[model samples]
Target chain A: MKNLVLASTSTLHGQEYLEYLLPLIKSHFRDCSKILFIPYARPGGISHEDYTATAGKAFEKAGLQVHGIHEFDSPHEAVKQADGFFTGGGNTFLLVQQLYRNDLLPALKEAINKGVAYLGTSAGTNIAGLSMKTTNDMPIVYPPSFNTLGIVPFNINPHYLDPDPASTHKGETRETRIREFHSHNPQPVVGLREGSWLEVKGKNIKLKGDLTARIFEAGKEAFEVEPETLLNDLN
Target chain B: MKNLVLASTSTLHGQEYLEYLLPLIKSHFRDCSKILFIPYARPGGISHEDYTATAGKAFEKAGLQVHGIHEFDSPHEAVKQADGFFTGGGNTFLLVQQLYRNDLLPALKEAINKGVAYLGTSAGTNIAGLSMKTTNDMPIVYPPSFNTLGIVPFNINPHYLDPDPASTHKGETRETRIREFHSHNPQPVVGLREGSWLEVKGKNIKLKGDLTARIFEAGKEAFEVEPETLLNDLN
Candidate 1:
């Protein structure tokens, strides 16, 4: 059985870091006494130690002891030993690069597949997908590869925003960028807006939260799926 | 005598494609009679031929003959013989991938350095910079390298937008992403607004158009440079 909570964002507008997801996280990691935190995706260029402390502070409310992988002698060993894991949000390119550099992606993937409880937000959630191609993050660093954990059958576009009909910005919209991805890649993409997430248990994946997510299948029109919709068939 | 007009966008909102930059482009390519168009960065999943025709239509008004690199028997030969070049906007990853795949990057760079008239918009303009690290496009495809032409010393964030203070969106703003880039990369980044561009003549580079471009230097605060300001010293 696989247990995972992949969210679009760690913090919502006007909310504290991971505050809105605390209730769900408490129940999700209920069985684990310690949670290993992967702080490679340093949001706002935060240091690993500082980022880990932030996560530790948030998880304290759930009575979960948190340790950052960076603090360990071996990140690969840390992944194998942890009962639960949490990866925070930042630049997806940097996160992916660091994961490859430390050579912990395989161990992390295997741990998640072995049913270790896992939590991912934004850049973290983007890596849970088949590839990081649909990530909205800038390519600040060149990663060795775009391939990810493949825990999810499809790719995820985190912090997805709908095009503002009244706006005049000429940059490619979230919708347009995903469409471009489908042009060269065959994977379906889920546009997970802020405050929404995918809850995966075993082989069952359900869309969680109140808002509907935008679904994009290659060569097909983008459609919306409501919360609680099973997304296992997307692969 | 490098003649180049690297624009932020090919089209402005409510304007025809490449409409806003026509006057500048015409003067930029005035000495050339033929223009070779590279349409590998196909916007909206448009076919290569269709994208080429679109460029042809726009350049026809300037009384210059237009032909896509794809139409030539040998793209390398076409580049060597062309007096002017136009690389239109689309996906930066795809454009770079194709440039490497066709082994045309070296040839294109050589031609540009030899004083061939060159015009780039969006993804095209992105490649004119040192690297595509600051590009806002999705990673639709994996390119051989993030390295680019480096015709200009700094990286470019085309269609650069300012943070909307009133918006509640949780997505990382353009400024945050660039700041993140600085943490990993040392290159300075120019945030070129839609109507702004960098006009490079020989070793002299100047910000053009009506808007003041945002400049981000590594380990320093981002600042603004007015139009006609020389940017040659940024490197």
Candidate 2:
């Protein structure tokens, strides 16, 4: 069975993101020898060996062998040797840049299509969508916004949170910002709040989070759906 | 001369944006009869008629004839009857939605290529770029992110203001948000802060605003440049 789990970030991962995957990781990959980790998304100016190590420790605690792809000469070789792939997120743009520059997106896409279990977080989730246009980050810099791996139809806005009241910054609120996005957009967007994730098993896309993900279509009010809602179920 | 003007939409007219365009509008169309206004971008829940009125009044104060394209049956006809076209701001997604649904982008692009002066502000400026991926608004909805008029190679993030400390509502600060975007992005992005505009005259893309605009390329620090800086001059 082809399985995919996407989270907001490796840093943000905890009971919320892991609860849904821990059982599966143990049950499915119990006899599976190794897991490949892609740590090439270092451009968010925050990627460190310690960060990747921490994430590896999580899987190690779950009884899986984790190997960083950076240790291998080629991503293809790494993928070929692994039972599954775990992609922890940092910045979607940085992740995609590394993926594209090294020509790994197509290879990863091929791996998924070939039935590899794929796990990703924030930036990883953004890459799973049709385009990076829906990311919550500002246009600080531009990567190939049009060069997503095309894993899903709609874009994912991960680490989604409501505007905090204690902070000071003048601009639209998160909801308003999203409303602004919907106001002009002609396509539907999935706003996955923090602690929420989307899991793909076979052809079923299930929402896994505490809050209902917001959906916005052109010329309509943004609406929310319960967790585990299937993408095929959305209009 | 294929002239293009981008305005700042703070007060909607007469002040920052129109002050710069009035003299140019008068000088460029001295022998021409009238200027056309395209006001279909009312998606931000803002007033489109009022926004257009601001431009019309500004042009009238300059002793130039201004007519809204809503008065015409089709944008093509509006283009044929006028010497130039001015697109006022609101929600760019809405404008692009109307343009795409009405199939007006190609028509506008054709008109600009045919030597008609094209002017845009905020959302209007967004359409002139290669894509709206850099816009500061929420991705509330999806228009055709691929259907921009392609007048410029990079995307425009308009109404682009720095984070203000005076208000209280917490998310990422605008600068942080933009930095986050840069962290992920692998391409160059033009961050056009409020009161800033870009002037495209023939092949020259000049920045015009009170403060320097911010530019970001992959894996580099964001740099700022003064007004009228040529696009090619960016390195």
Candidate 3:
């Protein structure tokens, strides 16, 4: 069984880090007091220790203590013993690279499968999908593979933005990029907008937020899945 | 000596393929009658043969003949004997992947060094830089390396977009992505907006177009370079 909060972003516009997610975090980790923070994403090229400190301040509001995975003797052991897990957002490539480098993917997946409370924002949420193929993050570093935890049946594109109708920029839109991904891959994808998240408990996954999430399946017209919709195996 | 026209895009908004660049193309390859087209980028998942034919029609308007590298018995020899070269835009990952798989990087570099007139747009322009690290394209596929021609002293973010002040999207802006790249890399980057290009002749490279190009340097404030600015060894 899985218990996860995969959010589109860590911070929303005009909000502090994880501020909007505090109440949800409190309920998610109500039975636990400590969280193992994986700060490898390093948003803005921040250091792991620095990123962890930032996450710690946010976790404190939820009445929890945070420990960075970097402080442990082994990342695998850190996952094994964590009361809960939280991976913050940053460069997806660097995050995936570090996960492979530390051999933490399998361990983290196993832990989450056993119902360890988990929270993933942005790049963190991306890795919970079938692959990191749909991430909008720049490839600052090349990971050995695009494969991820597959906690969910499909891929996720976080912070998904609608195309600007008035803009003249000719670069492919987010929808175009995801369509291109579909051209080369068979996996379905969910475009998760900011302030939106998917709550997973065992085999049930529900869209939880004020906004509707766009769902993209191969050879099908892309459509929106409304808030609170049960979406597991919908593909 | 090198002769190149690295464009921000193959076709500007509301224009036919290579229409705006035809006059420039005519002048760049004034002495050549035939060109070898490397249609490896495969924009929008287009096929090599189909993309090559499209380039052929565009080159015909400039009074030049187009031959795809795939048509030649030896792509290496085709590069050595090509009167001119044109690499179109598509997925950067696939383009670079094919380039290495076909062993065309060195040959193309050698040809460009020997003063072959060359044209690149979008992903094509990205590879003309020190690396493809600054590309705005998604990672649909993984190439053997991020290394590129390094024909220019810096990296290039083609179809460079400025942050929209009116929007509320939380995804990292293009500027932020480049800044993050600078954190892990020492390479300078040029944000070449649509309708902009770099005109490279031997040791001199000039920014051309009506808009100012944004320049990003490591460990320093990013600035803008005016059109026609001489950029060789500017660092």
Candidate 4:
């Protein structure tokens, strides 16, 4: 029974984001005193030590010890030594690529199943899904499509936005992109706009975001859901 | 071999677009007595008659006979009688939906194999590929993913453009979107800007446009090619 807190970065440091995440981390690891930071995703070309240092500072400011995974030779050792792991957001594609290149997806899945608190943001949020097809970023790089950790059944489209009228360039809107993804895919996708997240506490999965998050199941109308709605079975 | 000219419009009857397509059609089909308009794709939701009229009028002004496929109940027969066929621009997702629903893809493939001469614009251009995954439109509707006529090995991303600087909105750019597509896709995709076209003549596949086209192949740098370089491939 572990609590996972996935968050979009407010800034690079734990100091900036730790306030938002500290309570949740403390609630899960009442006896533990430290949080581990995973920075292997930086090699995917998005995150760097300068970026990760900010994340470390956020946790340190929260009065929690933080360790970078880069210190370990393998993700398994990092996970084993930590009470809970926090995966910060950078580029999900790049993150997954690094995990895949190092053959860590299986180990991460095992850790999650064994009750390692799993937290992610942005691109990290994408890897929680069955596939990364729903991601809104450009696939400027290639990663193993099947390498997702599968903590969540539906795909996560992070940084989702409503259409803006000020823009005149004519093309498909973000909602249209998600709809198109659903049209081609048989799986459900959760379009999580910024400031929104999905929280899993034991067997309970709660939608923690704005007024409503968009949910699209294959061949069905995409509907909005409040925080109280049942989304665990959405996939 | 039959000469094919896929146009962005069918009739250009009353629109200003005729000025752009009329001369091209006349010059390309100078030897042909008639041009067949495939209107079956209209049922997919885009206004068909308007598109047809646009093309029909342009041909008529050039003193060429323009016949709509509706003239015959069976498209197979229409293909047999056609000197060359012009497919107009519309929602390619909808067009392919209709093509799949009516089982017209195989029939059209047969017709093209017989050298009946096929020309498609927009949605029509999409179906001239190995698959339609590269289309820029939203598949708000579901369509069958089946074998296209195979005139090209990759999908055509029509109306492709770089992000407009004058606009203000936060999201992934078109370049990023195409890059995301290539990240997950193993096949190559050709991003064809508006007013640009791919002409397949015999063993030749040439790109015709005012600007460079972006070509994305999985695991390679997305490169740009001038019209001249692409034209060389036509032979």
Name the weakest run of 10 consecutive residues (lDDT summed) in model 4 chain A.
A7-16
Where in model 3 is the C-alpha error above 4 Å?
none
Q: How does candidate 2 score on lDDT?
A: 0.67
What fraction of the native interface does candidate 4 get right in terms of contacts?
0.07
Candidate 1 residue pairs that clash:
none
Q: What's the CA error at residue B191 for candidate 3, in Å?
A: 1.4
lDDT of 3 at B185: 88
Candidate 4 residues A178-235, lDDT tens each?
A: 6656545677888776666788776666788454788877778878888666577887
The numbered model that scores best in lDDT is 1
Q: What's the distance in Å from true for residue A20, model 2? A: 13
Q: How much RMSD separates candidate 3 from the native structure?
A: 1.6
Could you tell me which 10 consecutive residues in candidate 1 chain B have the lowest summed lDDT? B57-66
Clashing pairs in 3: none
Question: In candidate 4, what are the lDDT values of residues B1-235, reduced to their tens digit?
Answer: 4245433233233446445656666776676665788664452233456657766776787777777766668766766666677776555656676677767777777767667667777667777876666665533344555346666667667667776676433344666665655544666777776666776666566777576888877667878888845432310
Between prediction 2 and prediction 3, the one with superior DockQ is: 3
| DockQ ranking from best candidate downward | 1, 3, 2, 4
Residue-level error in angstroms, candidate 1, position A197: 0.7
DockQ of 2: 0.19
Residue range B90-162, candidate 3, lDDT tens digits: 7887789889998899989998999999999999999999888888877877788989999999999999998
lDDT of 2 by residue, A129-184 (tens): 77775666543333444457666666677766666676333234556655665544
* Native interface contacts kept by each candidate, as a fraction: 0.90, 0.33, 0.51, 0.07
lDDT of 2 at B108: 82
Ranking by lDDT: 1, 3, 2, 4
Taking the candidates in order, what DockQ does each have?
A: 0.89, 0.19, 0.66, 0.11
